[model samples]
Target: MEDVNPRIAGHYDELAELWDDIVASPSRERLLWETFEGLLPDLEGKRVLDAGCGSGFYAARYVERGAEVTGIDLSADMLERAREQVPDAEFVQADLTQPLDFLDDDGIDVICCQHAFSHLEDLSVPLSEFARVLVDGGVLVVSTHNPVHDYVVVREGEYPTETMPGDMEATVETESATPVYDETERYDIVWNSGPDSNRATYYRRSIEGLFSPVLDAGFEIRDVVEPTPDEAFTRENPEIAAGFKQDAAKSVCLKAVR
Candidate 1:
């Protein structure tokens, strides 16, 4: 928890210029978008909701495809940058852990959230809210770090100081549990400043990618795609590019229809 809401927003506001370049580097996100492209059935006049839409990169693609798009984020700074790049999208600011303020009941045709889940203390509430905002038979697409493919590589283990060119594999399995963040929350992590500070993220997910929520939310799993990148990702890691035939390095795609 941060007390500096204004500073938090300002940090992103100041950092907004390099936001896209920093996150989508080597174009892995194009693969993420290709996953969305595969999931969208048809969007000639559909209404789409992009939750946690940081900078509207995903929303702009939907808008271009003729879907009316609304995007929401917790950071007003990110929303500002999104507005500059994607003027046609409806962008707003809202806390994702709570019910949304800007949406109407059964008003959305599709729900798309990327790199945003598991940031909250719990998944059940937001999952329910996603169902509430969507019309019946609509869709929800969520892309996340594939806990299935590479959890042990990230925890209770080590990576080379640099990612070397090789087939990296480990047989170790890890399980992560997410409980509401009470004052008594516990972690065994050893915290430090340098690599840990800038690179640290706080939440964890259930093992490997599971589908309990889609069933609970009443959406059917349509497709789970690990889409290929547009030229940039392949150039960075030819091995990784081909391995999409098997798994993803940092993220996985989940497409469910309401």
Candidate 2:
């Protein structure tokens, strides 16, 4: 697999300082966390690997639940912030698309990779690595951009789309819309934090294409969740919440057992 970590790392380096505010948005973080938390196994005394652990937000939560947490990310700047946020947990700068040399086979009890897969060109390598590191019956929790949602967004052009950054190139085929749901494509996703905008490349895949790699990697799929905004989000942003519920899910969360 081609290494896209340097480019991805550069994109996140700029967003590291604003990461907290970016995810703190009710529409994204609140919905994601609520869904991911519900799928977590008993974490106490477990060995948890926080893959693509940006700023240790989720790692801290894992630690709070009494799990021994190790966080890995491509961005050194993000890892630095993660270390500060969760000093109790170990943080390493590593690429998800490569072998996890730092971990032993069947050593991890849980692997949490939240909103990170979109950056990768292929899922097989990482899923295989996850399977390698996770003990039998260990849990794997992942959250990523919902392909159905991306299709709707691109077809309707209801959401704002940005150009790929000049220095960062998309490795996969880039398409605004595909005739079939099975075609995987790369997209330029923009996130606005106040007046500043940060753009990154994301790969959109069909539901089947997304999960097939997991099954192929020897994981038994458990639960697949399309998270809806809760009452708290509805109370804060009624219009957005209504749109979220009425439209396709913005993200899909999956829980699988190794």
Candidate 3:
């Protein structure tokens, strides 16, 4: 159950162009695209489905709000920068932990999956392939990593506060590897992204591992949010909005439905 897509596709294929320059830097992405554009919805003709679509950065804003996007991912160098940023959407090269089969069933209507749902090792196999290609009132959204404010970091603790009881090797630029969790899997974390060493890994869960497998893969939650730092992102980072108003919600955003 720990495939972890070849070291999460060699850590985003080595930070695919510094992650599209920190998502087009708005003073280092503070209002994360105006809090994911108020959790989207009225995407004109809908159909959406950006699922893990990394470099497309919310699939070129859901194809400039007229929807009908597609975008999938798993880094073919972040789908060649999400097909040069949504050149009329539809860039594939899938693998959201497998089994999408080029979509069909209900045939989508909206999925999103921004911060790639904590880089899933298993989230009921992409929430049961997003409830078999959505459609019944479809609407997923997702965004993640807020297991008590992005795995409880306060400073200088250098990860592994309690999870590694077996496999180890983390290093990175000096080259060690093997990360995807160990100690009976205390929700995986592994770091090294900023200074270029590039070793990444995600999964943190717990908020019932992020909404009980999307309510047992059927979906219906509706809205959860938790995002903050607005006032022009707390005046362009007041110490990261005062450590995000004293921690515990570095990001959450949910929405569901299907």
TM-score of 3: 0.31
Give per-residue CA lDDT, model 2, range 150-240, as digits (tens): 6665555445221112233222223554435687766664544322224566677788889999999999999999988778778987876
Off by over 4 Å in 1: 1-15, 156-200, 208-210, 227-236, 239-248
| lDDT (10s digit) by residue, model 3, range 136-171 | 988888767666654353121234311122243343
Q: List the candidates' TM-scores in order.
A: 0.72, 0.87, 0.31
Ranking by TM-score: 2, 1, 3
Compare the candidates by lDDT and give the number of the best one: 2
Cα RMSD for predicted model 3: 17.5
Whole-model lDDT, model 2: 0.81
Per-prediction count of colliding residue pairs?
3, 0, 1
What lDDT does model 1 reach?
0.63
Minimal lDDT window, size 10, model 3: 174-183
**CA error at residue 223 for candidate 1, angstroms:** 1.7
- Per-residue lDDT of 95 in model 3: 86
lDDT of candidate 1 over 1-258, digit per residue (tens): 543234334434544565676456433445665665677768769998898788877788888889999998777768988998899999988777678756888999888888666455456677788888899988888876555433434354432211211232222222244333222121222222123122223244444224675677677887776555547667876765665544444566888877
In Å, residue 31's CA in model 3 sits off its true spot by: 35
Error of 1 at 3 (Å): 8.7
